[model samples]
Target: MAASVQGGRIGNLPAEANAFVGRRLELAEIAGLLGAERLVTLTGPGGVGKSRLALRAAHAARAGFPGGAWLVELSELRDPDLLTNTVAQATRLTEQTLRPLLQAVCEHLSGAPVLLVLDTCEHVLDECARIAQELLASVPELRILATSRQPLGVPGEHLLTVAPLPLGERDDAVALFTARAAAAVPSFALTDANRAHVAAVCARLDGIPLALELAAVRLRGFSLHRLLEGLDSRFDLLVSPARPRLARHQTLRTAIGWSHELCTPLERLLWARLSVFTGGWDVEAAEFVCHGGPLDAEEILALLASLTEKSIVTRDDEGAAVRYRMLDTVRSFGAEWLTGLGEAEAVRSRHRDYFRWIARQGEAEWLGPGQRMWAERLTAEHANLRLAIEECMTAREPETALELTGTLWFFWFACGFAEEGRTYLERALRRARAGGGPEHTLAVWAHRLVTVVADDLEAAESVSAAYVWLAEERRLPVPALPLTGASLAVRGESARSAVLYGSVRQAPAGDGGAEFFQLLTLAVQAYLLAGQAAFERCAAVAERLRAECAKRGELWMGAWGDFFVSLAGIGLGHPDEAVLPAREALAAKWRVHDRIGAAAVTDLLVVAQASRGEEELAARLLGISRRLWHAAGLPQLGRPDLSVFHREYERRLRAALGDACFTEAVRKGRELGPDAALALALGDTADAPGP
Candidate 1:
């Protein structure tokens, strides 16, 4: 079952960078179709400008859809199974529940009028159809606009066949070519001398937008007459029998082939090597992975520049670095050539090596002054990291997969990708189970420790036995003693605290920053679990860790430290003393983007506030806590015993305030969004005004 949710809102859509030429008629027809039908698919071969036309129409129709129009680009996504997740991510659905994601999506769009543009659905046609069908059936106000090389053929799908640009005397085809040429050569124009030659080039290319654009780029280096002459040779070599297939597909292939024919050997080799990359890449990455054989490391940048100039690869100048990406059509063409050359595996191996190095560097640098920077960097490289895992799996190199997964544990933990991380970890474990040896043992323990934090007790325990046995057999020092201690403490198992964390009070200085902070936080929790007798000692330890975290600028860890210290104060019957620290920790957790942590700590803060007789504020916080818990896909988190105070505190608040008053206060609190709640928790009440 899905929980109640706000109406859907428009997510992100890529900005149009260049002038969109001549789709007025098609755009009007697409807009009309979308208004009259539930599912409108713009079908045509790739490079026939289906994507550009659809995006323009969607952007223009945004105001008509009250909930807003959203675009989900499928070209970079390879796994069809992730179609739902990809869409959910694009829509920014953060509900991490046991309910099916589809159900969550339906619940989100239940009463909203939203237009979803599924771009480049050809590769995942069936999956896209299924999703559109399901969403439309469940959400009466939801509409879908999909673009593909062929029809989705789902019932009630209105197909708008996207044809090539009209090859008339002054149609879109010639206009698009002239515009691109002017950009490439500022002095170039449609003069009487070269107009017929340009028209002939466009005609031979079947009036395909992609082909004409490619031809125009060549004008920067070749005359119009030279381009037309060279195009004939390439088209002759690309000739195929007249079959019932896409003319633009053939035209696009020939254009891509002609571009390849025009490239220098080094540029051609670099293009083929660049195909291994799923997303864009920097010159450093291209140099490292694509350099070898005839392509010298020194020549990569120059060749990359040449390819960018020719428009085979586009460059994204992101302040610090200029990254490059080939169009999906171009990348696919290059990938086919790479495979035919029997160098696909070799290229992929290089990619995996480069990414492995990056993962290790990130893991190493994640603990100090660069913690936040490293987090952002890893998040940006996440797609490429996934590709590395795929490469390892494809090569049947489970050990490499294990190494990469183990190294990325900190990233997953800090960034809240627990679910997706678990998927990769399990896949790696299965492949490594046969003869993984020591690395396998380490991976198992790492996986177990992460599971405990993700609130998966069953999976945690299932691996706990294996991890313990392996540690004993291998005589490997157990590095996650604090995690076990925290689990026991939250479970009210004070008796086991001595065995779990008693000897690890001052974990060796050699421990990485991630391990040290986790150990410190969990140790404090264990101390608190010793009941009132250990309150003073727990508070002291937590305060020390909090001070250490402050010194190091670790906001997230400091939040947990404050949480432990606050609990200690509450355990000592000083609930008022707990309020400040708990509120501080709640604010810090939200700042760190730890939603689950924020939710868990908010309950404690609410209790502390109520105990101090701040009935209204306490009731409001309780409502916010409810929303946080619901957003995290749980009624509660951590050990069930840890919820005792949460239940008791709410009970007390309800008694102090009448039921109706409590309900009204909660309604107000629920209005505090994630950002506003954090602001209120941080004592920034000006922006989070009460309803």
Candidate 2:
């Protein structure tokens, strides 16, 4: 009933990779389509990963074809004149010139059973149409997988549209984000506090994978509510002309515009208002952030339901119970029009306030599972979270200003989000300090937080005076003592900070904040600056603190606990002993976008690695630390102190290792500071020095 591709052969491939995701059904469907059709064309809106799916499917079904499978990546070839050459390349045909290439491919595959994967052929649809027609007529036993935005205008070509993943199930987009977030931010898991919200965010993303990916990246900086708000206002910021071809395909704003032109006014406003979050938000956030107060709760609910029907907004699988999000594109489109309507500031104010409320809720939850959940939610809303801080600081809303800064502490430190955190916290502190009240306590908190995330300590050190002023002038009877002390210590008052923490520890810490924070002070004093015995003392104290935190179900401070433990391990000259905790700390810190935490722990990890003869790893990590530190405008690590370690590290490490800490910085890695960078450089040398 259908054409048979027999005796066609495909060539060698990259090691059958599994790094790719979500194509099982497509693969199967493609297999079935190939078995049943002469020519099959897979079509999607764009960036549907059609080529990837086709290649994977072809790889998997190659055995069935026996002649093998081949790929013609048509996306690169714009000249129709080069179509034959492109085909020749895909078939691996040698060409003295392009003259004989097409004929040569036709002859070469005459007796072979092969499947040809034609990727991204939409732009040159005519050329593809001609090629497919010619190849099928002459070769008899060839199958093709051609991807185009629209049909290739070829006969016998069956089209398959790859839609976004279904959000009807519980583990659809939310599950995908959960898996991807954990991958990007290791050990990240969906927690009860954010389960509903995360699901809602995923659903609103309309299950578009790339949109989902960008949202996940945002999780490194802000809350879900914060992300939503950005989604509300992003079109205003995201619109810059891209390369014409790319502008349509790559920009979320364009993608949403395509969808938004299909919506009504109220629907568009509803969409913009929904953008007031990074993660899912409650009905309260939506009503306050989106509606102009004239719209009652009931009317708003019905409008939201209407958006879901058009796929403009998606409620989570539990239906109306959860919060909502917009697909990145949808949100972008909504934001564009929201700005165009001159309602940007009015709506954005609502968006900011909603984030403030969410941040306060998140702050209250910082002590429990809520800590992780809200942290992740914030991580997804980095853009909006930042906007909220800017709005509050500019508007001089002291409470909102401080809380937005404080609420993000966990996320900023956990996921290595120090850069963004420092920006907003500084502005917030400036506002809080200018206002001059009990809010000064918050200004101190802001300064301390900014310091930790500041890659460049020099810039942050200027604010050290303010941290001290807060302690001297506004040190609350609250346990914010260690926080202030730790800030001061990091700014260079180590001995005094050690004593400051001692006072907090001495005070009867009846509950949560004091105990958890004071641990930071003691750890800083005993290990960061002290000798071997002091490290042991720090270790003992940290171990006790860790157990106490565990007993109270407070793992929020685990990164800090692990950081101290690794320091003790490194101080003891047992770098190997430091490895596990250091690695764990790095992973945990990254999980929550705690950039400073990751950097601090990595510094210790490098010390341990250098001590243990992992010179190459040390060198790589050292480089990373330096980059991170520089980005934060912080002062450099003691190059003189680190030189000895670097030299020693080179003596032992002849080979660098561990994917060099993410692909973009494979050579330099994102370690901690100059100390770590020196170690990494040493490790990179083939003839490294031995310990």
Candidate 3:
């Protein structure tokens, strides 16, 4: 599923794993500010719970903003240039156009009331401020809740300084400590025997949620009296009364340092090394990236469990897999220690190398039964992949960057990241050329294909010419011949496209070793045949492709096959027979979060419904298709052959329903949310409107 489709909301705010002990008043205030102000920043020192408060407030206010609340995490993002792209991706605005990214983001949000919580903005303050300002000015109903150490300095910004929890006998800090302590040790509780000690520990830690939680977890290894003594000594040595302003900041640092000191040497080594990951990483990634020297791969799981028990690292079981992440404050501490150990570069290199291996593996297996699995795994690793590419560019390893980008073309193309892929490919190509790096043929062709899919024909043609030259020099067959045929078909050259596509089908079995590409070739050929009025040939090819994809357990390419089969059925004057396959294709596309494919299948449904004399349904479906295309950031499929059918069927519907009824139906269809629209399109009578 798309990241935006979290439950029914278009956001990715994580569910709170533990009880929210405090922040009741702050939550109310932040909620009120969000209602009155367009932009609000929760400013405070690190580990004062800014991110947690922001998430709580956003979730509480989610209902008011129908567009859904989204969290845009900036901690893992290092390069300032990717701020906007990161926001766009987090908001799930898959802009498949050449327009400026910020412009597309604004346009996507202009029509809806969205709440965006930008977490960890201090590092990219200027960029965040600029984008926040632009988004606020351009989008009328958009609200942003930012968590930063300092203000964004944007106009109309409301600043809410988050403070640590209050410490007292029955305050939130003690309650939080008690709650966490219970989790750490089931027998622990707030009794007369230990209540005073727990309160003392919270007070000494300044009632900071993170610090208190860290202290509570120490109950697993230390007695209450011993934990209190350890904190007393650590605080006295670390905090100077002369620097009151930095006292809480220093105290939190001291707490984190104390935790570090308590770790075994191997655990400390692993902690520092795991800081190299961006976003959350699974156990497998942790093992591959952090295992070396004193840290053995087999010891990683136990080490991870220990850290989780210590509350230094958190585990998330909400996704398809279990993943772990350090809070930004904790991660920063680990990063500093890693640097202090003089192992930052080596660990980061290993991080990049692991992801590079992952990319190659994903590319090799993407055509098989693991297609969906690879897509989800790679999507989960999106941030790490970007970091790896960024590191390559920073280290002036453009050849590595080029090859990595090339290897991930399937991910970018089939997984709804074509625009992002184009951005990386263009950057890598430019850098490689400037640095005089060898031009990898795969990278060159990958760039051409992504560019074409993103509707940048001019840029794609330029890169295609380069690839053609390179192919001749190397005396090898072009691997992108199917892409060339696709471009030709898009430009109304059906005859030439057919011949090129036929040549690809006739190539040797081991020619490309890319079953995905072969399936795509067949789908494209089916579309071409349909456009040429050869219904039988189109049906046959589409069915064959669909059977192949089904046997391989692939849904993306198979959905395309379903679409073509429906299209050919309608062309063969069997509208009734097209309905089932059209509905099936639409559902499958939506399942894979293929907005573009969903829109295409919805268009086919419109034609199918219209041919069956369901003019009203067709008009409504046309509206839904328009909305889907708008969401996909495209006018249509960008295929002239497909466009011809849509235009013809739409004209017929307009005449049959008349302008007024057609317009009203379309309006209603456009108003439906994703779930409701899909339900209605799938013939769920409950969601169907009255005539």
Best by TM-score: 3
TM-score, prediction 2: 0.48
Q: What lDDT would each prediction earn against the true structure? A: 0.73, 0.58, 0.80
Worst 10 residues of 1 by lDDT: 1-10
Best by lDDT: 3
Evaluate model 1: give its lDDT. Answer: 0.73
Query: Clash totals for all models, in order?
Result: 0, 81, 0
For model 1, how does the per-residue alpha-carbon lDDT over 500-596 read when each residue is reduced to its tens digit? 4444343333334334535454544535553546777778778767777775666677777788788788778899788788888876665445667
Give one digit per residue, the lDDT tens place, for model 2 in 97-132: 212445656764555567888887877888889988
Please give the TM-score that candidate 3 achieves against the real structure.
0.91
Q: Write the per-residue lDDT of candidate 3 for residues 1-691, one digit (tens) a residue.
A: 1234456656667787777778899999998898898999999998899988888888889978877688899998887878888887787666454568788788777666889899999999999999999999998999999999999999899999999998987998999999989988999989988889989999998888888888888999999999999988877775568864347888899899999999999989999998989888999999999999988999999999999888889988878899999988898899999999999999999899999999989877766677778888998888899989888777755789887888888888777787788788888888777532234666777777666752445654555565565456445454444555666666666677645455333323322234555676688788778878999999998998898888767788888888988989999899999999999998887765677888889988888888888888888888888776766656666643445655776678779888898889887777566677888899985757554
Q: Candidate 3 clashing pairs? A: none
Tally clashing residue pairs in candidate 1: 0
Worst 10 residues of 2 by lDDT: 1-10
**TM-scores of all candidate predictions against the true structure:** 0.81, 0.48, 0.91
